[model samples]
Target chain A: MEGNIYKKLLEELELGNKAVMITVMDDKECGEKNCNRKILYTEDNIANSCISDLNKVVYEKAKQSLETGNLEFVQVNETESYLIEPYFPEPRLIVFGGGHIAKPLVEFGARAGFLVTVIDDRPSFANTARFPGAEKVICESFDKCFDLINLNRSTFVVIVTRGHRHDMECLREVLKHDTAYVGMIGSKRRVKGAMEQLVNEGYSKKKLDKVNAPIGIEIGAVTPDEIAFSIIAQVIKYRRLADGKEEKKILSKVNWPEIDRDVLMELCEEDSLPKAIITIISTKGSVPRKAGAKMLVWSNGKVSGSIGGGCSEGEVIVKSRYLLRDREYEVHRVDMTAEVAEEEGMVCGGIMDVFLEPFWN
Target chain B: MEGNIYKKLLEELELGNKAVMITVMDDKECGEKNCNRKILYTEDNIANSCISDLNKVVYEKAKQSLETGNLEFVQVNETESYLIEPYFPEPRLIVFGGGHIAKPLVEFGARAGFLVTVIDDRPSFANTARFPGAEKVICESFDKCFDLINLNRSTFVVIVTRGHRHDMECLREVLKHDTAYVGMIGSKRRVKGAMEQLVNEGYSKKKLDKVNAPIGIEIGAVTPDEIAFSIIAQVIKYRRLADGKEEKKILSKVNWPEIDRDVLMELCEEDSLPKAIITIISTKGSVPRKAGAKMLVWSNGKVSGSIGGGCSEGEVIVKSRYLLRDREYEVHRVDMTAEVAEEEGMVCGGIMDVFLEPFWN
Candidate 1:
């Protein structure tokens, strides 16, 4: 909260350490007494209070979430519910070619919560402004970018360059990597040509089979936006539906982000800031954000991230002050199903299960 | 519209006729005088006013939308704007199993504007209450239900039955039909067993290749809802993409939906109730719905569908009444860029271009 919990989380993510953030979601009856009672569990350590009964309850669920690699909501008790949220630094889209289609693909990817990195030979094609929301924009040739980036189980390589040769080149490099998905945008004829040549060059039929050439779901999309939608849909399909068949990474213990972990590292380095990480693990009905949404609460009333900003969040903020004091990892529920929600000007009318866990490195 | 305009449209759709409905999307500046200028064009015929100068302009754009199979915003005249919207009886999700995963899949499908239909052997498994928003719930075996339904270019067939045998049975049957997608849920081992048996039994590799066995995207989904997320994502992928390559049907010239198509058809039939079909063909900035969102403006001050119901829509309704009276087909612009937009309680701070074409078929 004081420095950067996000950066610290990213650091933990780098170490390939699976993170299970447990939160208490009981907004109504629990009051502010048990507001900030949350816990964090890693493979080697537990943060906040992971020794309580809820820890035992959440541990198994967290392990399951880790195994499945999906976010879920669980009932901890009658009035209290816990969200067993697993953070997997998976589903990264690396788009080759900052073309028209890349615009929407990057935008959609970011919105769908994927870290999208775009590469292009031209500066005009690959710029921060064009892909404002994208994580990274590399203005370089496909060959250069290909050599620079890492291709692993989490990587989804998209070949949508301006020309066919570039696409073929990107495809060639991607097929050899530990990439989870490799989709190249091309006509049937063009893809056929590439495949024929690659096959002749001794690329295995199985390797060639991995590529989703003519990338996209094929809604007969014509425009860039429409085409982008198709491609993203296909990516999501591959990301979620695969049967352990794609490039999965060999994790290195204690992995961390090389850059931009400054804030979180700063927070971890500084012990004075007594903060709690509040994650919206599970939601029922209508809510602003889906599961896995997080917010950091500081004892002095500072916050980071957002679990939807409204009177509801304001209430959570107030509770964070008490929870930080109590150090109780309580499941707090937020019922925005009434006129109170309407009066609070909440867009979604649903219940939210929040877990406010005190932070510990 | 007289004597089932909805029926006529349905008839056209049945005949495999693609229709494009064009509208103007400016909600701020263009008042109701330019509201009712909408035109509907099919593969062979034109509705509303096709002979006008604007007809030529919209004709090309509409044709483009049809070819692209997507909704888009276009510039009609230098000053005028139009939205070339294609009416695709799209998002039809057909679930072969009424199992655990199918529950959330159906629910999500319905929410995502899909006409969902669930098929199961057990009566309890397939029921209206289980899938309230679904168009149909068939309480019969896969064979019985498969024989009853029409598998077309738009049908997204999902197989998530109880056991491996049921999954294989559904997959085998689905492979023969005209379906946009066919996904079956199973463990890797089970899927392998089915594949091996089907292959040994002389099922062509080409035919079996279409199935998305071990259905849904691979998000490590453990729970039913999480698993459902992956499946729905795959279905949506197939729905939006395919580029005439994936089981695009050889249309019967005139095809029709056996269920639904009530709204547009109803509008067409009520000659006494003249109306304008307003579709948000494209969008910019932050709006509630994107392109392809629609609303029906009736002469008697009634409306159907929604193009983001708020002050913005309220303004469109008022303008629609005027356009209906004037019989004008004007491409008007709506600018919600000013503080007036925020002051008027508009959630999105952007401009919309609305086409108000008089409905005279």
Candidate 2:
């Protein structure tokens, strides 16, 4: 049953649809109410859920995760614990010119988890050989690219055409799209001229305001690669969704591909036998990895993920097997500051408290 | 003479001294007064120069470059063309706590060209084994770190300690240093409380205003790595000296180490051979490398710097040798958009205009 639910989740993800998965972790006191159950939530509001009252919490958490695109640990009514993970579509980076800056931009964009697309009027400029990382290479006029690709809120567009003529044409098309970020690279005069023309043509000043003209976080980036770095930095800045000031956003853990795939698959399996899962709950001073890094240990000593693979993990692994024998949920303190840490051939010099919990069907 | 200049320059850099180098690239009409010349500019005002008028321009450029550490191309009196390279001491990054965020910050700081140091009271938290990239790792009390290391205007300090008490203590120490940037990580309330305490202790509101509290650019970065990215991004934004809206800075090419060292070394060589050097002056559309990239071509087919090593370079290399035969200074353009670019097993899909300059000592 969990497999079918996960299959749907993966399918929705592949289709570029948004979703949230809720997995129950603890049900020690909630007898026979589908303890340790799984639920799936989507934008359609039609979801696979269990245990009333907990479903309301899942719905609220699911909605919140959609905004942040984060994974969360939710305490469902104090007795039920659920881990809610959001699934956003692969981020799209649409480049409106296959220019010099676009070269490194595409490379950086791809490396930063964007499905990059390069659009140019000349076939020579937009091709696979130059942009191997680009998901699509559209060699068409400036206006044609808009009609070709789907530009939605998830799409990040960078306009860096060769001339003002091409830049103006692309600006027209970009304004029409429902996009997340729109950055145009040009001199102040060039960008202003393009924007003024668009405004004169009846486009709202508010619409033009959306564009990050003279694009990027000004890093004194002069070369194409430097400019590329600045542009990507700005994109990440926006994607990270920074509030103006003094707003300490509660950050979600890293969107680990390994965890999304491997852990999800493992959890979906119909393994009635219990398995110990270790999560770094707290940390201090020079830890190799951060909190949110997880490691799953089996009774047989096999493992998945890493809590900074060192003597600390070796100790945790031994303790995890012991945990499996006792079947007691415990918090294991790993202190890697002693001389033994150096002797173990590790560089970590911090203390971490890991919560070891076993999951059973 | 050039070697002594560079050795002095490097030594001054190690000592955190600021200086600038002005190199005369071309002077076709300036009589027999050395076509390729080098000049040094420092606060001592000692300079070995040919054109006194050009010396004024060098001084002005040097002063501006000092404010923003950047390499500039200066044209003096429309006749004396020079490259003014600014040399400041390696920017120092001093981390007050060797915590999770410090790990990635150290790695990123090293990659972004900063001499880093990690300081903490716990020997386990602050050690060489954890921070291989750090120039110094001080395992002492937070207050003791300041007395251990020299904190000058070129230093950037980040405080991310285990406790608010330690963070405040580090902040108090940091405020005493003449620093470039100061950031402290904590909740807004924590930072406010620290600042209030400092204000009560007679620190001016203006002085406390400089601290980037709750550190990092508002990227809702939660994980240590993500938070590190935001902090570094903010550091760069400040370092690059963004002057806010409409003042789009004219960025120079990337401070390429190879170009800086090789070109400087090559110019310093006493060889009187009329060597033809190729410098990428301008580029457009999908070129492998950016403008300001160089390729020093000798009389033979040997080359030093790379402007994307492919068939495009092969063509440039061939053209470079041809220019050497005639010993003529010319701007030879290489258009890689043609079909030949593909046939040459090349990936470049842009045009590059290279300045082929012949240097005669």
Highest lDDT: which candidate?
Answer: 2
- The global C-alpha lDDT for each of the candidates, from Candidate 1 onward, is 0.67, 0.69
Model 1 stretches with alpha carbons more than 4 Å out:
A1-361, B1-6, B12-18, B21-63, B72-84, B128-135, B187-205, B219-226, B243-263, B273-282, B288-326, B339-348
Q: Considering the two chains of model 1, state its CAPRI-style docking category.
A: incorrect
TM-score of 1: 0.45
lDDT tens per residue, model 2, A129-226: 99999999998888666778877665788888776677777878778866767888888887888788888899998778778899987666655655
lDDT of 1: 0.67
lDDT of 2 by residue, B124-237 (tens): 778899999899999988766677886765678888877788888888877876577889998888788888889999988877888889998765565676677677766665
Error (Å) of candidate 1 at residue B88 is 1.3
Residues A113-152 of candidate 1 have per-residue lDDT tens digits of: 5788999988878899999978889988777786667677
